[model samples]
Target chain A: MPKIVDHEERRAEIVAATMRVIERLGLDGATVREIAQEAGLSRSVLAHYFTNKAQILVTAHQTAFAAVRDRIAAQRAEIGDPVELLRVALEEAVPVDARRMLEANIDVAFWEFARHDPELRAIRLDSHLQAVEMWESMARDVQAAGSARDGIDVEAFGVETQLVIDGTSLQAVLFPEAMPPERQLAVVATHLRRVLRQ
Target chain B: MPKIVDHEERRAEIVAATMRVIERLGLDGATVREIAQEAGLSRSVLAHYFTNKAQILVTAHQTAFAAVRDRIAAQRAEIGDPVELLRVALEEAVPVDARRMLEANIDVAFWEFARHDPELRAIRLDSHLQAVEMWESMARDVQAAGSARDGIDVEAFGVETQLVIDGTSLQAVLFPEAMPPERQLAVVATHLRRVLRQ
Candidate 1:
């Protein structure tokens, strides 16, 4: 039989390497040379999959998020209580573990780029808006289940929760010593109670 | 006197130009070449003022923070109430105005770099620790004045406040349309009340 190659798997490998390179070296230092070295592929071979650094970063972001998305999906399936699921759903977004620490680092690294590039900004903004909408849906489910107070605006709840979550992740990535995973979790949990009471 | 230039003043001007460029093009895009163009000077002239891009970034961060530091100090001097001062102190760190928006952009742009470099990481960490300490001191004053409930962990209060403050700035810089000055103020104000009651 002739040799068979899986294009998608190779691309996924390159994206994972890009993320690892980004995690080890900040986005500023994640050169194509470095990413190719991290991926154990020649520059020419890497280009066969990704044309440039920008494309690789975009793919890395999309793929890195899938981990958190899958975790949240699993939580939604296994948990029975809306409030409890909300907590776990949020925990997945935060940097409470090694996997998430990489994700959060990758997430923040992209923000400055988004500020400069319109395409990246659109992708980032769409992702955050979707995240907020998802949280709002969860908040609505919580309220409908009688866990949250009446008259709460689920949209506002979603926005604030997303802000706090982002804030917590930023804090953890920048100052991991002071903002341990436990403390990050506490901040989100406290936010849940404060918003739920409103 | 022979022709003389104030070295400190010239350095300050370069730092300002660095901020403008970083705010517009982001740290990744804010090459020394772009910064020189923004400053209306040749790269050689820029080299006379600073050694490299790394030094420019460090100086820009330090100087940009001075604006916030000055605002917080003025608020402290003007306000007689502790809780109110706490609110304004937190506000100075957030990106509520054009000036602070620039500061916020510069601030978040540094996070990924700090993650990769040890010296940068230490500088960033120390600044945050100092900020948290500043908040804790302010919280103590609030508690002593009886504005806040007794027995709250003032240290934890400071840490969480700083996290939210940073989180708000990160959000506003990335998505200004969603987090306006009014809404940012509301988030900080709400956090103040929630922590105080605890």
Candidate 2:
């Protein structure tokens, strides 16, 4: 019998290696050779999984987003309160721990890289739209459930809420000590409370 | 007679060249040769002005910040209302024009670059603190003038305001067409009005 090749597993392994290389050497320094070395695989083997460095980067980004999405989904599965669900979902986006710190570093590098790459830019914009939609849907659901205030423009509120989360995440990554996990959560809570009905 | 050399003018010229190179070719691509070529100066001449690429990057950042500061000061000199002044100051920070777009590009690059360089990291942290302090002072002034609400935590309020501005600025730069100047200003105005007492 022929041996079974787990293509998905192999691809994920390569992406995991790519993340490690990026964290250690930034985008500029994350050369193919360095990534292969970090993965303990030959450059040719790595190339079999990814066409080039840029492909790996895009995959890395997708992997990161998927991981966060999974975590949020898992949390949502357990929560029943609409307000608490939204709060936890937003708070999960903040970089307050080791996993998030790594994600933020990769995100920062990707933003800089995306400035010149059209494909990467598209991926970024698409991801942003998805995030905005997620928040808008949540806000609408909560409002319908009477937990959130009526008369609030759900779309604008969603945009502003995303702005605060993205902004707070950036600050948290840039100044971890100044913006601890608790502080980040507090900012999100403050904004949500301000908009939610008493 | 000795040649009267304007060191500051020459440095400014090099920084301008660096910015152009950064705009055309990202931070990694804006090498010594490319910058020298862009400025119409030889490599040796460029070397005479700055020691390395890092120094040039630092100078470029300072130039960008100074330009924004000067613009804000000019606008402030003509405005009398404290609320209006605060609005104008915060609005000026947004990248609503070509010049600001270039600054944003450089800023995005610098932020990623600063992740590893301790000296650059220090500069970034210091600049952030300065921005926070400036916003805090402006918030206090506006609140004291009875334009803003009382019993509000000015420090936390200022930090949140800065977060919104910085976050919105990032989004505007990333998606200019989606987030036009008018939209950017509207978002900031909305946040300010929400916090201010009617």
Candidate 3:
């Protein structure tokens, strides 16, 4: 049988290439032709993967978010305790490398686009929802395990924790040296520990 | 002799008009002609006010930042207490109304432009410096009042506090219902109170 290319893998490759193009050239300069050239593919082939430039942008954003989601999931599994899980989730959000830098770049770009693009807007909203769900799950499990304080509002705490994560990401991106990863982790740990209650 | 226009006042008016243009149209859509139209002046007249589009964008960003600075200074004068001053600064960053909405929109738009525009990048860096100064001032006052612990790392705490403020702004802008003004204020109050070793 002839070799079959993995569609999902190919799509992700193209998406990663799109991000490289965006970071190399600002989003406005990241033209479809430029992206295709960077991806080492024909324009028709790139279009075959994503219908248009907007779709490509959207895919790149979703791809980046999926990576973040996977990182968090992996971190959650690695940390046995809920308190530590929350810590890991937050630490993951801090800007640590070029990938994270690109992620932050694409994230703010998506937010600006959300003001105008409905599809991007929907994706942005969904990503927040996913974040909320992930935190709520962790909160519930922690509460059930009696690791969290009795009578504490799990949902509210979850939202607050998410805020810290979201906020930390912005600081890390804009003021990386100012809000170092260690500092961000410490703050997250302190906040989560306090909220956990005895 | 004919009356002469106040240069500073005229410049402020032009920057204000630039903000209006930004709010109506996205950053990319705000052209020199459009800004001139919004300012109710001829293109040449607007040119006399700001040399080019980049100049107008940076000045408008600086103007928006100045409003926040003025707010902080005014609030600091009224509050006297460091924690209270910090709270007021947090409130100023939130999306309180159409005017604030205009300011926030321009603020976020500037980040994307900063990714590419050297002038905008410098303005962003300066804004970060201003934030650090604001926090450092608050920290010193707090320590002097004996509300903060002795030997407090004012610079570190200041950076963290600014992260909270900036992060809260991002969350409030992204998720208004959950991280609204009141909720944000409460979260901030809790964080501020936690950091103080009183």
Best lDDT among the predictions, by candidate number = 1
Write down the C-alpha DockQ for each prediction: 0.62, 0.61, 0.43
The weakest ten consecutive residues by lDDT in model 2 chain A span A1-10
- Provide interface RMSD per model, one decimal: 1.4, 1.3, 2.2
lDDT of 2: 0.78
Q: What residue pairs are clashing in model 1?
A: none
lDDT (Cα atoms) of all candidates against the true structure:
0.80, 0.78, 0.73
Query: Residues B1-198, candidate 3, lDDT per residue (tens digit)?
Result: 223556667777877777777777867788988988887889988878777766766887888888888988888879867877766676676666667766776776676567667667767877987887878878788788788865667876666666666656666665566566667766677666655765
Models 1 onward score TM values of: 0.83, 0.87, 0.84
* Model 3 DockQ class: acceptable
Lowest summed-lDDT stretch of 10 residues in model 2 chain B? B1-10
A1-198 per-residue lDDT for model 2 (tens digits): 223356667766778888888777766677889888888889898888777767767777787888888988898789988788888888788887877877776676677667778889899888888888888888887898898765787887777777887788788877776688888877888888766896
Q: Report the alpha-carbon TM-score of model 2 versus the true structure.
A: 0.87
Model 3, residue B73: displacement in angstroms? 1.3
Candidate 2: interface RMSD in Å? 1.3
Interface RMSD of 3: 2.2
Higher lDDT: candidate 1 or 3? 1
Model 3 score (lDDT):
0.73
Cα lDDT of model 2 by residue, B19-134, tens digit: 88887776668788888888898999888877777777787788888888788778768887778888888788888887887777667666766877879988977877777777
What ordering of candidates by DockQ runs from best to worst?
A: 1, 2, 3
Model 2 spans > 4 angstroms off:
A1-5, A13-42, B1-5, B16-41
Task: Specify the poorest-scoring 10-residue window by lDDT in model 1 chain B.
Answer: B1-10
